[model samples]
Target: MLILFGWRTTIEQLRMLSLVCGHCHNQAAHHLFRRRTKPTIFFIPLFTISSRYGLQCTFCGVSYDISKADALQLGAHV
Candidate 1:
């Protein structure tokens, strides 16, 4: 039997906010994202392997990790 399996990472944009970046200290738009890694078999997703949340600054392109609760709150648009 031929078995193909791999892990895939999906990044979803949650929301956009105007805030001051901690790294660049510039007032700019930031994008919140939810990143999920899932195991796939035969190109079909089976289950999630890991998950992460990130907040990225548009101008500085700096990314910061955030809590899942905060990501859920920011992603209320769903």
Candidate 2:
């Protein structure tokens, strides 16, 4: 068996891609954090992640994956 560590950030970056809306083809921005009540627990902290790039249209919400590569590309562009 193999064990992998120190990849939490990478996993998160990949997961962010799913939020992208195929219809809109625009990156969704992180709006705000909302508190959610857990079924087992009384209170739980939850966050709403969105994209801050691309155009947001009515078709749907789109969010792009912000991987390390993407960050580097953005830095170079700037």
Alpha carbon lDDT of residue 39, candidate 2?
28
lDDT of each: 0.88, 0.31
Compared with the true structure, the alpha-carbon lDDT of candidate 1 equals: 0.88
Global fold similarity of model 1 (TM-score)? 0.87
- Candidate 2: list runs displaced more than 4 Å: 1-59, 76-78
Q: Give one digit per residue, the lDDT tens place, for model 2 in 1-78.
A: 653322111112211222344565455543211122222222332333332222222335433433445444434231
TM-score for candidate 2? 0.21
> Model 1: residues >4 Å from true position, as ranges?
73-78
Count of steric clashes across candidates, in order: 0, 7
